[model samples]
Target: MSVSLPSALIGPLLVFVLLDGFIQGSVVSLLPVIRDTLHTGTGPAMWITATQFLSAAVSVPVFGRLGDLHGHRRILRVALGTVTVGCLLCALAPTLGVFLAGRVLLGPLSATLPLSVGLVRDRLDTAASRRGVSLLVAALILGATAGTATAGPLASVAGGGRTVLWCLAVLAAVGLVLALTPRISETVRLASGRMDWTGAVLLGLGLTLLLGSAAQGAAHGWHSPPVLAGLLLAPVALGLWVRSSLRSSEPLVDVRAMAGRAIAPAFACGFAAGVVVLGGQGVTVAFLDAVPEEAGYGFGLPQWQIGLWIAVPALISFLTAGASAAVGRRLGYRAMLTAGFLLMAAGFGVEIVGYAVMATWYAGHLLAGVGIGLAVSGLPTVITEGSPRDRAASATAVYYNLKTAGGSIAGAAAAALFSGLLTRSTHQPSLAAYLLLWGACGVLALVSAALIRLTPRT
Candidate 1:
């Protein structure tokens, strides 16, 4: 079927995608500044990042299922509006606790990307849908890159860290406006399933505990009572969620839907990629911050400069993601994933060498950017291709949730590792921490490669 959307609709949708990235990227980009301003250690700062991911991890699947039940466009509008409020709260927050409250509110709103993707699928014909998906994905990557890269400059322009939060609030408001534009249409109005409140609550609690425990374990010691309790509760909650889901007349997560052969592997690849890429990025940022200026290990760049440096890689990733869509059509999804993982592995290896020499680190970051772009872009396609027609949105949501969770795991792990190294050494630990992180990322990439290879060709 040939579908013709008004030209006006495209700009608003595109802006929404970009804004989604801007909010997420801005939050992460603020990590260094927040750490400095709050007088909090790396562990707490890491939790700031982890909280956003954990919240999103808990919300995405639930939101996706809801979107499918109600309407994708309606959900998008509500989410964007809620995000605007959250961003405003963040801007107004006077303390770290208030800021964290804002982040928790914003977390569920992060499902905007998947919801947007589903909207595009619902609105467009096959050809236009494919192109729309590609563009939306590219926008998402660019938004993240731009947020990370430009946040520093913007903060500098605004005159302080607080100004950056104001800037994010403004961007979020713009997104909300775009979301309200009348040109957008409600699509995929599925039969209303009973809202599985019990299952959702159980799953959310389980994931939050599991992720929270993973994040805090590094800081408090794994054996700490709180950490142990969270860990202990995670499995029990998960088992309960599973059991409830299996028995429910209308389940929340739909476990059986996830059992499809192709969908399972696609999610596995995405989750694994999320862990390595996010972890690597966390380590790189931390290394930049902790390294001493006098020691050849540090750039000693200000937050703005570091933020700008991040942009270079982000731009490269955006460009590569846009390119990968076309390439995937020709080479197929498996080939693209394999190639992406290899490039990512190569990037990590280069980063390790650069740290060893303590020279020209930007080149390594650029390589890593390209790898992340390529790998991340291919993930949606893999999930979409494998999913059942009715469950496509939920399946994609599952992938995104896993990806967010993986990133949290990686960030927490990096924090723990770096903290451990610092405790042991009086001198700069940049080289040691980075080397270990790079090696870990390389191993992750290799595992992804192997997984891709084992999967049957589409």
Candidate 2:
């Protein structure tokens, strides 16, 4: 039960996790620039980021299945190669549609994080693997921060954001090269069968439908035909897939295992965790920019400062992740999750009731970050520990997919909450909308904490 990981194990995990985070964060940071360069409207422009979200949700489970069927290293190579080619396409694309096609190729990176988690579990001793997982989580968050903080400046230096794609391509290339280097060893028994292609298709289509609707629901009226079709069919398709999986001798995911008390709460929290982390981030930042100086709610910070300020919490979150493993071990994973969510609730609560001074804002964010770091670090460990060693990738992928879905739903909720709020001439949300966002985050965090409590003590 030694909780120390060797550099050999930690290095590859960080590389893949960081790549995933960097790609996601950088692509998002580039949307406005892409829109300006392509001369596209917000609706068309959204595909830049939305495509990643949709693809990630669907592809994660498939990658997980692939890992269970094949070796994780094999799948990891494919995923890294996919990202490399995708970034290259993005860099070379002459048109918006072509760029989007390139984005579709990069979707496999979504699966890389969970796959890395499984890789670590396969290679390390139990306690060391747990610590490795924490490092992976930290790299995921920290790399996102690096992407957000650096991409803009890098774009400026390179004369456009397209060069950032080139850099990403390079990173992906390095990763592909590393995948050839034999370091991370596979230890788990591989699940045998033809890959569950039918289940994969169903799951992919269902997620695409649900997330596509959510992404577009803000712009298209909720009652729009496209949105309505997705809303209705998503569940039907998913339900059929579930029924099929239960009957199939070999399923992509073990739906039955998901019902066990030990695993159930982790899945539940997975969804909430995504909503709070991604959605809470959106809400917190939007509030910072939206609160007018005259309104005494904000200090009228510049965009760079605003991003930096927002990172205060994220930075704290990143640092907390490294220590989260040991902390969770001492505190118990359940207690850690409970406290984390409670802290997040407190963070949002401050936003809801307190003044918008700089100190108050940072304090709230820092507290929330601590909570997020603790909960996120704990959830997957629970999943890995509870799942059969052979199905670790599938289990981790399932949790990760729910997290992506939660993020999509939360984004839509934020849009719905702030819809139609035009601040005078500016296109920002009104103060009231920001307040609502904060309150919503607080409530969701509280709910997440309650879910952790529902976990059995076994």
Candidate 3:
């Protein structure tokens, strides 16, 4: 069956994704400024970022499943509304604790995209759905690019970061308005059974413990009492979650299906993409912002310059993501996926060897951007199409959560590397820290490529 893109539906969905992406990108660039404004140290400031991802790891699946049980459009509106409150809270937060709480509420921001995917699947034919999904992902990257590119300039124009935070709140409110409009169509409520709250609570608790332990381990030594307690208890919580899910009639996630051939490899790719891409983000920004004389290695760029450098890769990914579906069809999904990871590996390899040269470093980022764009766009499509139609949102959530989990692990690992390789005289992270991080990311990309090759073609 032939289908056309429905402007009424696509327009609002695009706005939601764009708003989410913009919030994500702008927050990263604004973190240092926010930390200073709140008079918090680096350790606590890091929690602001960590909280968003941690909460998202739990919220995505819960929201996705809710979208399946109810209607996607309805759930999409709820997610958008929830995030608006989060943005407002962050904008006006008087203390670090309040800001972190706001970030937790913002967790549902990640769910908007997956909910939109369900809508697309419900409303469009397979071909149209692929195009729709590609467009939404592209918008997300594009929005991130815009946010990164503009955040610094906007902050400067407004004279502080609070103004920028207000701007994000306003954008989220606008997205909510759009989602609530009558134009956006609701998806069919195909799934049955009530939400598995017990499973959700177990899963959320498990992830919170796991991520919290990693963060604390980085701050305190791994053997520290709190860290040790968290690390030991995390597994028990997760195992219980798994067992409970297996017994439930309608679990929050299909744990067994996630391990099946069709979905498992895609999940692996998602995790690797997180490790190779999101894992390196903070390091890249820090390297660009570092004063060479003080750090003994870096460009010593200002905030806006740093944002611009990061935005270029995001911009490239926007283009590549928009085109990924067409390219996947021509190259075959397996070939495209394998090639994408290889390109990311090549990109990181270039950075590892030629980091001293600005031109070469940029080229590396551009290549990685293309690879990430392709890989991320393809993985969701693979997962959704492979899943039972009624459970598509949950499957996508699993992929997303795995990706976030990988990033969390990588972030902790990078912190360890920096701590271990600090330059004594400068008291800053040494060049060895960067080299090791980049090299590890490159190797992970290469491994992902190999795993993709072994998976059956999509």
The C-alpha RMSD of each candidate to the native structure, in angstroms, is: 3.1, 1.9, 2.0
Please provide TM-scores, in order, for all candidate models, with all chains considered together.
0.89, 0.96, 0.95
lDDT of each: 0.75, 0.83, 0.86
lDDT of 1: 0.75
Best by TM-score: 2
lDDT tens digits, residue span 1-458, model 3: 33368888787888889888899989987887899889999988988988998899889999999999898989988999899999999999999999999999999999988898988878887777887888888998888778877887788789889999999999999888888788987776479888999999999988888888887788889989988888899899999999999999899998888888877888898998888777875588888888878988788998767877887888788888888778877787789888999999999888877888888987897899899999888888888887878887778888888888888888888988898998999889999999888888888889889888766775
Task: Output the better candidate (2/3) by lDDT.
Answer: 3
Clashing residue pairs, candidate 3?
none
lDDT accuracy of residue 250 in candidate 1: 80
Higher lDDT: candidate 1 or 3? 3
Clashes of each: 0, 0, 0
**What C-alpha lDDT, on a 0 to 100 scale, does residue 101 get in candidate 3?**
92
Angstrom error of the Cα, residue 140, model 3: value is: 1.6
